[model samples]
Target: MDRLKTLMDWFDVRLGVREILRSNLQGYLLPRHVNIWYSLGAVLLALFTLQFLSGILLLVYYLPAADKAFVSVERIMNAVPYGWLIRTLHMVGSNIIVAVLLLHLLSVLFMGAYKKPRELTWLSGFGLFNLSLILCLTGYLLPWSQLSFWATTVATDAAGAVPWIGEGLVTFLRGSPSVGAGTLGRFFALHVVAFPLLFLGLVGFHLFCVRRAGISVPPFGPSARPAGVGTTFQHEVHRDGIPFFPNYTVKELAVVMFVLAGLVAITVFAPALFLPPDALEPADPFTTPDHIKPEWYFLWAYQTLKIFPSKLMGLAAQGGAMTLLALLPFLDRGEERRPFHRPLFLTLYGLGILLLLGLSIWGHRS
Candidate 1:
């Protein structure tokens, strides 16, 4: 231990590793009022870390060819030691990450954490969110199961609904006219290479911004201060808040452990039970399933497209909705930060959540 500490001290002298850790973690002053909501970011980081590790292990066994992809997955589950556990972690972790991201986004929105100085942080987070979705989309096709194949077809086909660029986009995404070996190869390249790099980069930048700006204070608690105060929230936090290392870190660690336990329980018991038996079959282009739907995260948009008679209109609506969400920092320009203080915005937010929930349920039923 002394030798290890000496080596670390020698490295830290040249690399400033200790300083970086001190600034970002040990010495960081978080708001006293930061509750379970603030732990979402830590939980997300933990999930992404698990996903990255498990994905690497799975990649050792994954085959990208259309004919061999499904068979390779089966071999991994049945033949490779503990490969089933690793695969389950990757699959279930993807869904769990998405769920946690939604909760984090909602928490930020309700807290008005994106206001003023934190706009760039919010923008980086939005990028991370979109990248995660793309990662999920690209990875979905890697299994090359019947469900993945047809779902990819439906998703890519929807891109062709765009005005003039639709066909080109579809061709680019599938690497051919339809989903096939080329599509699997392209999606595999993207899932394992491109998206992961981008997600990691964005996550790094997001964390830097969070550390620099500090966590947003609660908008309702005793530590809450109005937005226009000459003194920034960061200053107030530093003055009266607790150091993150022992106080807040404990809570965040507990949350992460609980989430991991739940993930393990679900993986062990459920184990892709939600996936239909049809999904286990290899792709058959000649026959189409009776009901085709996207993953639950995207079901809202899929349902929205179905509601509109015109494909172009549906495309436009979906694009506009995403654009609006991405530009929320600008669109929701107001001095008020608390949800209770802003009834109209709060009501609109509630309605939007309900609408999305209703659409997801309806899409699943359909």
Candidate 2:
């Protein structure tokens, strides 16, 4: 213990490690009224860290070349130690993280935590939400399996539905008119390098903004919605609020632990749920599967495209909806934060969520 303290003292002298911890860890504060839903933010952080680590371990045996990628993954599953476990965690964690991220965003929306002074936070977070989907899209192609190859084909084709630059967008993503070695190389680079870097930067900025603005007081409290102070008021840690360190941090960890347990359980008990039959087959460019569908996350959009009269219209509708979500704070500027206080918008939001869920299920079973 003494030796450890002496070593810490040596580094603390140069790095001020103790002060950094003191200020950022213990000194931070959060409203006591915040609930488990708020813990979803911490859950997301944990999920992302797990995905990042698992991806790195999988990368150790992963080959980026088109001809070798599927063989590499197959070898990882059969030859490398604990390779299947790491791959499952990375793949399953990708889906879980997106789900939790969406829930977190919805919680904030419902709580009206995206209001004034928190607008930037909301925008940055929304950007992360979209970026996470893109990360999934890029990483999906890295497997170079039949499922991934055709899914990328369908996705890039959707991108090609855009107005004038559609063809160019498709060429840029695929590096040609078709999915091949060029597509795999581009996606591998984006997944491993370009996209991850952008994600980390946005994550840093989101946390900073959240910390700067303070966690919003739950929509109901003595000081939560004081009369008409909504437009004028900004979220501030109450003087009587709890310290973020051991108090709220413990809650975050509890939630994260629960989530991690479920993730591990699913990975162990039902690995085949995600690794569908065709996913095991190598890319066969000369042949297309009878039914090609994206992973569940993109299913709602995919279903929407199929239901729409045209790909351009479906793409436009999706883009316009996302734009509204991005501009929500400005669009709904009002003197209320409590969700039920804004019944009409709340009802619409709930319906929107239900519709998306319905579409996803339809896409899956179609």
Candidate 3:
């Protein structure tokens, strides 16, 4: 008992136990105005943990080599008992994670939580989001399925449209003028090893900043909570919240457990899907799918490639679009965070999402 006390004391767990728990939550207690939006961050956090754990399980059964990747996935589906369940959970978990991250980002933007002290937190988060997107893209190709292989080819081919350096870029990405064995190996390395490390490092740094900044209250501030705002438990139980531990922390854990249960249930019942048998056949560089396209996230970029004319004009459009997206933090340089306040930014952001979705659909039809 004395030795345990010593360890706790050394870690400062006794003196700052409350703050330590609060450190895990990037928010203001007695948040003044709690809503469902506030819960998104917690949901996203849970999703990321789910993704990582499920991915690790899937990796044990996954074979990275081109010849074996499809076979390994098949084994997971048919032979490995709970392997299909784990693989499906990982797949669904990835989609859910991305969706939750987007929702969290939009909620922060709408609430103007990205202002002032929380800027670094927001910036690091956005960067991490972009990296996660890239990670998803790379991972999609690692399976070497018909959809995965062709999707990658079409996506990378679009990259080759850059004016002077386009050809070189394409060659580098595809490991030649075409997609083949080398492309699969490179993507597998990126998906399984490189991006995961990069993502974890960024996530750690982002969480640290959140801990330092605390959660940004809405622009209305703490005084805005009138007497009758009792829709959610957050507004009621945490209206004048206590320390994160034993209170919010307990609830958060329950929420995570619920999400985990759902994910596991899906994984066990549904499994990761495989495309048609013909699609599973070896990749044909010469042939393209009747409706060749990339994963949903890349649809917009792919569509952008289609709209622009070839040569200088097309190159300009494609390059400019990519540059704008990559430099969003720098481009969206307003101090304002609320959607109503940043009308122009919000409008453009929405339009951009729609434009991408529309283009994706249009590109496929053509």
- Candidate 1 residue pairs that clash: none
Show how many residue pairs clash in every candidate, following the order shown. Answer: 0, 0, 2
Return the lDDT, model 1, position 288: 79
Tens-place lDDT per residue, model 3, 242-328, is 455455556666766776676666666644332345445555556666665665556656666567666446557756875665456
Best by lDDT: 2
TM-score of each: 0.95, 0.94, 0.78
lDDT per residue as tens, model 1, 1-366: 999999989999999989978866767788767789889999999999999999999989988898899999989888999988999888999999999999999999999998877878999999999899999999988888888999999999998988789999999889999998899988898999988988888999999888777677789965455676344445334657787888888998999999999899989999875467767788887777778778899999889889999888988988898889889988887867878888998998999899989999998898
| All-Cα superposition RMSD per candidate | 2.0, 2.1, 6.2
TM-score for candidate 2, please give it: 0.94
lDDT of 1 at 363: 89
lDDT of 2 by residue, 1-366 (tens): 999999989989999989888867787777777799999988999999998899889889999999899999999888998898999888889988988988998898888888887889999999999999999999999888999999999999998998899999999989988999999998999999999999999999999899877777788855667323444645465677788899989989999999999899989998787888889999999999988889998999999899999999999989999999999999988858887779998999899899999999999899
Better of 1 and 3 by TM-score: 1
Instruction: TM-score winner between 2 and 3, please give it.
Output: 2
In model 3, how large is the Cα lDDT of residue 29? 59
Q: lDDT per model, in order? A: 0.87, 0.89, 0.68
